[model samples]
Target: MPAEGARAGAATRGTQPAEGGPERPTRRFPRITRDTARPEGGGRAASGAAPAPARQWPLLVVLGTVALGLLLTSLDQFRPGTLLIGVALLAGAGLRWLLPGVGMLAVRSRFTDISTYGVLGLAIVLLAMMAQPNPWLQIPFLKDLLHVTLSNK
Candidate 1:
């Protein structure tokens, strides 16, 4: 059998200090030394030297639309406001897909950002279209499904 020291020495060949050298922390998923590169389509909408807001116009447009939607909702115009909010998110998805320089609007990888924005936008729009007393759209099985799941019996 190998000695305990032999086992440890073999196990830590690359990681161990060279007989009293400085201790090096372990690296995990750290091939790059400084930082990761930005995702595709993640550059500024405008060139540098522009104001920060102008550089990130895509994100701002979506945010401004949503803010307006919220303002309408606060004034008791719920359905149209919600529709506008959903449309803003949908527009964000479109911008992420179509624009090469979306700046901060590109949250993650292209596919992930597109998928997330599309799904959330569609969900919001659908829910808004189906909200309460006299919903604009309906799924016939959803009522039965909800009843079945919620019933104690």
Candidate 2:
């Protein structure tokens, strides 16, 4: 067995200061010498990061439009007109989903938005019209003209 002092010497031998020379400096994180060691894009290391989620706007819009159409169709009175409006609304929404570049008009322009709303409003008006009985022609000019032309032949 070695003496205590000899054991201490053995432990410090490799780490000792050279005769007539200064001791070397030890590093805490040898892998990261400078801040420049980081890449231009700084964040978590490459080893274990989670991936980003994908966008699904098209799916969302289609589902929403279908729901709206279904609700409109279920309402009492004006079922056919409601169905027509639903069809138009769904067609427009479908176009917007399928063709985003063209849909930009729907998103960005007030005119297009108003026009779409106007079409919906017109559908409602047509529904009202459907509820009322058809009005007979007051003048009956066209029918008379047709009768005269047929009798002359």
Candidate 3:
């Protein structure tokens, strides 16, 4: 009985077989752990007991500005609303770059966060500038490209 238990334990732990036909493969995955380490720079934004909102103020501010932008759009203020939303994303990128600890705002590595924010913000702002009904900016090639792509004739 003791020998049987020893053999089973050895097989479970290592590649040693209990009653080997051919050495069985070991577990492919390791045991799961309870918690993961917090992402770097994801520390509490405001130290001490300042409540959750205050701690993640950067995230809240960005989100609030976005919400306001959305409200403006719903109220038939399209161009300004989109412009505001884009500006908010740009601000989020700046905050992520400048601040060391930004609580939940630091969802990914610093570079990734900044790159995502900057690209999306720039795209939105550009699109807003190019929106219809007397666009502020124009790209003549885009019209040609779309016509080439979409035109049946």
Which residue runs does candidate 1 get wrong by more than 4 Å?
1-33, 151-153
Best by lDDT: 3
The order of the candidates by lDDT, greatest first, is: 3, 1, 2
lDDT of 1 by residue, 1-153 (tens): 567677556445545554556545554444456777788888889999999889999999999999999999999999989989999999999999999889999978999999999999999999999999789999989989999999998
Report the Cα lDDT for residue 55, model 1: 99
Q: lDDT by residue for model 3 over 18-94, one digit each (tens)?
A: 67455667765547766877767799889868987999999998999999999999999999999999999999999
| Best of the two (1, 2) by TM-score | 1
After the best TM-score superposition of candidate 3, give how far the Cα of residue 150 lies from its true spot, in angstroms: 2.9
Q: Which stretches of candidate 2 lie over 4 Å from their true place?
A: 1-68, 71-105, 128-153
Choose 1 or 3, whichever is better by lDDT: 3
lDDT values of the candidates? 0.88, 0.47, 0.89
Best by TM-score: 3
